[model samples]
Target: MKSETYKITNAVVEDIITETSNIKTFVLKPDKGLEFKTGQFVELAVKGLGEAPFTPSSDPGISEKIDMTIMKVGLVTDAMHNMKKGEILGIRGPYGQGYPIDDFKGKRVCVIGGGVGLAPLRSLLYELMHDLSRFEKVSLYYGAKTPKDIVYKNYVKKLQQEKELDLFLTVDQADDSWTGNVGVVTTILEDLNPENSIACVCGPPIMMKFSTLKLLEIGFKEEDIYLSMEKNMSCGVGKCGHCRIGNYYACKDGPVFTYAQIKNFDEIWD
Candidate 1:
């Protein structure tokens, strides 16, 4: 890691969009762009509370402001959720290896996400959607606890109208308003043509495990599958030892890794 990795930049809260009951998208404007790639993450710090790593959820092409979708899960996130527009937050780094978009060209792509896991994958989607001609096909399979808990309702609805992209949705438990599949996200992977394709997955531990298994069961190669570990990394740099999985430092080597690179680790899914 470089010395500059520890330096924090000032980012002002421009707006906050309530995505679901407990999830929000924070709009932050730094003096300049954070310029992060699709899967790389940054540390967002509250003035006094603390900081946590979050992947940027907005378009990778946009430069002025960045969007980070956060679930109110911990001390830093809880404080961030309570913050108002115009509050100044500290931003540092566009750390770790991002999705290698070039490798995805000329191949079918599947993005699988669960709950807030969609946040990081959302950035990859924007990059893929930016130039649809670069890939053979692109599809998204997502599931949440319920219809109301779905993170990006308007955005998902709009994707349906876009013929270029395929969207399949499901909820574990449904209400009257639900019309999609009602099982785990892996349920939707049954119909996909896993051959000549690559799948990128992010979610809670259980979700990541089954999604990987489902993808493998359906004929996807282990090396062709990508996962965002998104572990509780206390420091953005590898020295903290908080994000080490076996010999690899997930902070420095990857938050995004191919299944073949990490499938041997017993705690990978945890």
Candidate 2:
């Protein structure tokens, strides 16, 4: 497992689905099938353009093809946005620790996401829904800057219709056609039964910070709050200090960690 973690395998871009104005999901077919834990990430790259870390948004159960939902945020992503169907990219990983799904068994699982952060959580949701009998309840609460900014439009519709899952959505700003809650995601976080439940959070650092505070106010324990910290992670392995946080490395020890494992670090939100 350690040997394959750093090896880059070639993958072809089979298709791309435009999710929003800024985000798109790339369907990649690697030379060999790659399997990863739901919340684990892969380092995707072009031969010369360099690599970046991204959590696969596809269900972990399907390893034949990997789906990566990326936003056009920087140079690498901009080039990727312009890539054609036949283009190739390098892939490395299944790295870092993923969501401990086994430990979450028999407990209520709440997933919270904002904007593109939903990409990673979507994979987790798939696994939860795949085996719904393992948990007591499964719920998703997600928010975006505006109705137009919401990713996975059609997929979210199906999520809403799933009888075993509870889904809630909110937008920071609403247009004339928007009918959902018209406030930040925290506005709809009320009435949560934090006891005996576990929550996973991912989003912009500011949104993550405040959402965590809200979860705490509602009585969620720090040990039960998992945060996805994917900031400035250049090299997926531990050698690169780009993702260092105090004594631990986000890309190595985590990208996923419970709140109690990292809340003491002052630079976590940075």
Full-model lDDT for every candidate: 0.90, 0.91
Candidate 1: tens digits of C-alpha lDDT, residues 144-220: 99999898788888998999999999999999988879999989989889878999999998999999998899889
The whole-model C-alpha lDDT of candidate 2 against the native structure comes to 0.91
Instruction: Quickly count the clashes in candidate 2.
Output: 0
Error of 1 at 199 (Å): 0.2
Model 2 CA deviation exceeding 4 Å by range? 1-5
**TM-score for candidate 2:** 0.97
Off by over 4 Å in 1: 1-5
| C-alpha RMSD for every candidate | 1.2, 1.3
The whole-model C-alpha lDDT of candidate 1 against the native structure comes to: 0.90
**Best-fitting candidate, measured by lDDT?**
2
Candidate 2: tens digits of C-alpha lDDT, residues 67-168: 999999999999899998989999988788899999899999999999999999999998888899999999999999999999999999999899999999
